[model samples]
Target: MSEARAARPWLALLAGAGYGLFYLYAIGDVTLYGPPHWGAYLTEVSLERIFTARSTLMFEAIAVIELGWVVWLFSPLNLFLALILAGLLAANMHGVLYIRAHPKQCQVGGNKAFIGALPALFAGGACCAPSLILLLGIPGLGAFGALFGWLLPISIVVLGINRIWQHGHGAPSMLEYARQRFGLNNPSTA
Candidate 1:
């Protein structure tokens, strides 16, 4: 592969990492305290709590790392979940980038990749819903708790299904399907 082609995968990986970090921050696993102070670091790990679940799929943080002004509550299970979601997102992003680079050849619009991205974004929201629901004073606490707990898992399943579906359909097939669904006039068929 050429230099540009080689860089695309790396770029996608970076995007995934950025999103994973954002998810961690949103869920209160990672936090910022103040300006960075070089050479300041402290960490604590509780092996006993490594596999504990705080709520539904949410796991307890078995480790804590304090680096200068940043604090991270590390949970292996949660990190694994984040990585899975991020990897799917990165794969979709790579598809989007590839489509953008060779639009004429791909034929399919980049919107499908954008649609694939929605699940991960929505999954991130699931992480923050609990705090938001409490602050908003929602009356149906129990029902909301049950619903919110499953949102992340549901999003993961959706993303997995989308990945399989996208892989099974080639660009031309997807393009034709999009045209049919949206009533776009395909030159060949016209």
Candidate 2:
């Protein structure tokens, strides 16, 4: 690998880490990982949603399917929703990380920003939708919470779209470049 190529992933890492720490201290304070009640990290199904569930056999089935889809398509989460979202995010991150670490793979198609946004929007930000944020004495964090809530999720979307555009334009992602430089290309060997 060339010198510049070697340095690129570190740059990504540095930027990612810096942003992570900033988000961690700024908005992540009230989150589960921070000082708030550990339970704050968790999301539970709303009683209202359960009660409002559609009736009728077919409609119920459709509603179930729709509910599942809506949960994944959106960033909101409860206990079940958290599990489902975590599973999907884990799978996606696994793929993205594999592509980054593997030598053979050359495309970084997944948006890692989602990894950050999930925690921010769901556990750390406005969408926490629970008393966790309220428990924290710092009302100033409300602004941080709101900002990161929207910013992180929106960044996830923008980054995803940007990745697609970059790939479409034949640009190599940092992961792809790093894979070609340092990672094994073969899956079997992995």
lDDT of each: 0.66, 0.37
Q: Which ten contiguous residues of candidate 2 have the minimum total lDDT?
A: 56-65
What is candidate 2's lDDT per residue for 1-190, written digit by digit as tens? 4545433455545545444433323322212222222111223355444434221100111121122212111112222333333333333333344334432343443344334334423432333322355666666665654343444344344445544544443445555555666764746556
Model 2: per-residue Cα lDDT at residue 189: 55
**Residue 40 CA displacement from its true place in model 1, Å:** 9.6
Number of the top-ranking candidate, with lDDT as the measure: 1
Give the C-alpha miss distance for residue 133 in model 2, angstroms: 17
lDDT for model 1: 0.66
The lDDT, on a scale of 0 to 1, for candidate 2 is 0.37
The TM-score measured for candidate 2 stands at: 0.36
C-alpha RMSD values across all candidates = 10.1, 12.6
- Tens-digit lDDT string for candidate 1 (68-136): 888788889889988977776566555555555554555655665566556655664566687677778
